[model samples]
Target: MRNIMYAAVGLMMTTATAMAAGTPYHEGSATIIEPTDERNPLAEVVSGIDFRKSMIREMQEDEFSNPGMIVVDYGAEIWEQVDGTAGKSLSDVWESCAGMDAATAAVSYPRYHDGAGKVISLEQQINYCRETAMGAEPYKWEKADMLGMTAFIRYQGNGEAINVSIDGPAAATYERGKELYYQRVGQLDMSCAHCHEDNYGNYIRADMLSQGHINGFPTYRVKWNGVGSTHRRFRGCNGNIRATKLAYGHEDYVALELYLAWRGNGLTVETPAVRQ
Candidate 1:
């Protein structure tokens, strides 16, 4: 969700600026490179803009509390199911472990994990907590059980503003991700900016692709019949680009997500459970 923001802004600026300067793209892919001379000024747009406040406003008629509920419901069952060597439930260790009570905590994750030595997404964070902290095995990212647990957890933090940091190592990772967002890659030879930044709000096949904000995720994703994680959607975009996607728990993705969240620092979170 965050990374898409950078791509959208950069794509728009990349084209609009090029036309104004009368700079021509020496290109195969859709991206226009930075011009050497001011008069010949086609340049790659910097991928740091966040556009969530306005984006969320569009969904004011909708809400962000439902996804958490659905997930929380499923998560409770998962938590209660016996597992591990002793076949013990969460009650054997922690009384609640926020199963339903702390759904809001999901909104605050994808944070820096000093032990992991990098920023990790909420999905990854939950798995780690479940494994080491809970003395249970971790759930897979795409599992219905895990996804439900995550949705329920994140649901706990409805209505809070997004806050992300790029200080220290996170800063470098964000910059690199920014560069990756703008650089053309793969057989399509297109970077994220090519479609998202350069062609936002334009018709893509049939859909009028908006600026591609991340505020709506963990979107209800009606297509999925329930809520979804932001990273799952991110990987879908990469697959669409024909680019070899980074892994689910890739550090690059966490870095990119961090940068994106920072870009959208003031945006409100909206979840799937609540329909607009």
Candidate 2:
């Protein structure tokens, strides 16, 4: 069954790559405009607003209308439920270690842990907490439960500034991530900076490009009809570029997440952000 699923994913990725290769953006004919220039014709008109449109934006603002909140609610339940050999809930373990609520815990994530001996994302830390504190098996990266729990935890940090560290143990990994951002790959010979940095506030067909910041993930993408992690979106973008999509929770993705978080250091946390 697992092999079948892997084959299905591989097939889907190939199809997506084939489709993307035909687009003008992939063909290198799409107009690239500067995002920083207010006088640039595309500056005012092109914005991240294209991602959610208006209706989804309105829906996102209303907590009751947002479907993603269902996952958040479920995550809250998981936070308190006792499981594993340690027989403790996530909430209990976190509170004991950090002396704070989950919301604050969410803010200081993708941090370097002495015991883990590396920098880890909030999602990775959650699984670590589960395994060590609760003596439970770690949830799969693509699992719905993991998404739900992550959303719920991140919700607590909503509106807080992203402050991922690049010092000490995180320094080397952070550099690698920065390199990845600028390293050109795939048949199109594009790096992340090509579209997001050099050509931000530009149009590729009807779609407008932004800096591709990760401040709002795990975002609720309307197109997906569900909340998705940074790594999941990374895979989609990689597929679009006809590049090999890395597995979820891979060290490279985790390192990339760290660098991206630092890139948007001053931005407010917008987990469960609505996107098209």
Candidate 3:
């Protein structure tokens, strides 16, 4: 029965990939989703929330009902508290580095880091500050503090459009990410395009598939019973396909985050989003 199930899945993957032929980005080795200026109607980018059930959407819309708010509130507290050998808090450094507020700094992420000499995700930036400026231990990935912190930052950018850069040095990373999205992985032989790109709005068992946009991170998930980061969600997707999961903040995952963020282009930030 398991073998039959795997076969069926393989067939689905092949069919999905074939059906997506001639489509941009996911179709061939070409990486550009579309020009930065012009929008593609065929690849209409929509927030994942649009595909969510109304109840989930309602939960995301209302802060009182949104369980992720609790995490964001916790993060706000963390932002103010001082820590590390430098005797600084995220707030202390915010004024010096991240520009006026978290909200303004939130939309730009998976950016190229000169020191790191590679693209890094928002979560990594937080940790970089902790290690370099704060002189503190970095928070573990997907944990309460990490989730709360990212939720807080992302929430500040709420309603803003996602605007990550994949130009110059970041271009290689974006290309790698685009490849990862379409590359088949694991025992099921499925890629992100199989479920999100091709089968979005289609049902896989009880849950409906979405376009898999990452405009919302540190989102509250009913299945998780709490807010989680995009990398956490990526790990879950890999696991779902029986693929080998990488550690949190892995370079490939960071690159993939860039691709996903760019794919989301103008979608409004919906941090602490509710998903089932």
Candidate 4:
């Protein structure tokens, strides 16, 4: 009887979620206009302030209490572990090749890499450094160790601003990303701008929408109960809109990442950012 009851409850919950997703956003609910103040443009649109009221926010504030720190700790171990034909640790290679510590390295990511002849994200750079320095095989994109190492590195630059360059070789990619941001698709005929730019600070059902910045990527979402990449979140957003999801590390997504990083130029990096 208990097993039957549990199955029925799960079915009901799934049905409720499906029903909620199918409900359209009311026109009146999204009418809240964004503030025009240039000095504090994001002040009103960002959702962190409201999120801080929750118990999950408290966990994020306290390093000892946050579960995501476990992954960060594991990543530190990976950093020190020797690997590849060169038999150098990630830390050794990063110091020798990049001439910067992991903490500061993340701040300069999603930038053009002359050797690769394209823009690269922090995750890609880490893998590249691994391969070039040690001749080690790169970790898959969604691997826990990869996520952990990314979180560990990004945590070092917690308060630094996102400073992705949109100049020279990166310029064309940035333009393409901008076009994708405004291009409407899917059966719903919506673009990123329709929800994030047009209706930021407005209510979508019970949740308030924000400008959807990527500064807090590799974030620890309460919904996922795990750390996820910006690409993962991007794919989630696409799925929510009924759009065909792109593969992780797709060039288009990389371009989009560069654009979003530039869009959030001044925002502080909030790796392992706690979110619902």
Residue 30, model 2: Cα distance from true site in angstroms: 25
Cα lDDT listed for each candidate: 0.55, 0.73, 0.80, 0.74
Model 4 lDDT tens row, 1-276: 999999997886575455433212222222122333343234433423232334656677688877778888888899899999998988888866655677667776787876567888878888888888878999889789799888888888887866667879998998888889888977788998898877654557766566777766688888998889989988998998889999999988998888777766766777767776
Which of the numbered candidates is closest to the native, going by highest TM-score?
Answer: 3
Can you give the TM-score per candidate against the true fold?
0.64, 0.79, 0.84, 0.80
lDDT of 3 at 7: 97
Could you report the Cα RMSD, in angstroms, for every candidate shown? 10.9, 11.3, 7.5, 10.2
TM-score result, candidate 3:
0.84
Give a tens-digit lDDT track for model 2, residues 28-83: 54333333323222332222323334576677667888777888888888989998
Candidate 4 overall lDDT versus native: 0.74
Indicate whether candidate 1 or candidate 3 has the larger TM-score.
Answer: 3
Tell me the lDDT of model 1 at 183: 80
Which residue pairs in candidate 3 have backbone atoms (N, alpha carbon, C) closer than 3 angstroms, thus clashing?
A: none
Q: Which runs in model 3 stand beyond 4 Å of their true positions?
A: 1-42, 98-101
Better of 3 and 4 by lDDT: 3
How would you encode candidate 1's per-residue C-alpha lDDT over 168-200 as one tens digit per residue? 656677676677667887767887666666665
Model 2 TM: 0.79
Evaluate candidate 3 by giving its C-alpha RMSD to the native, one decimal.
Answer: 7.5
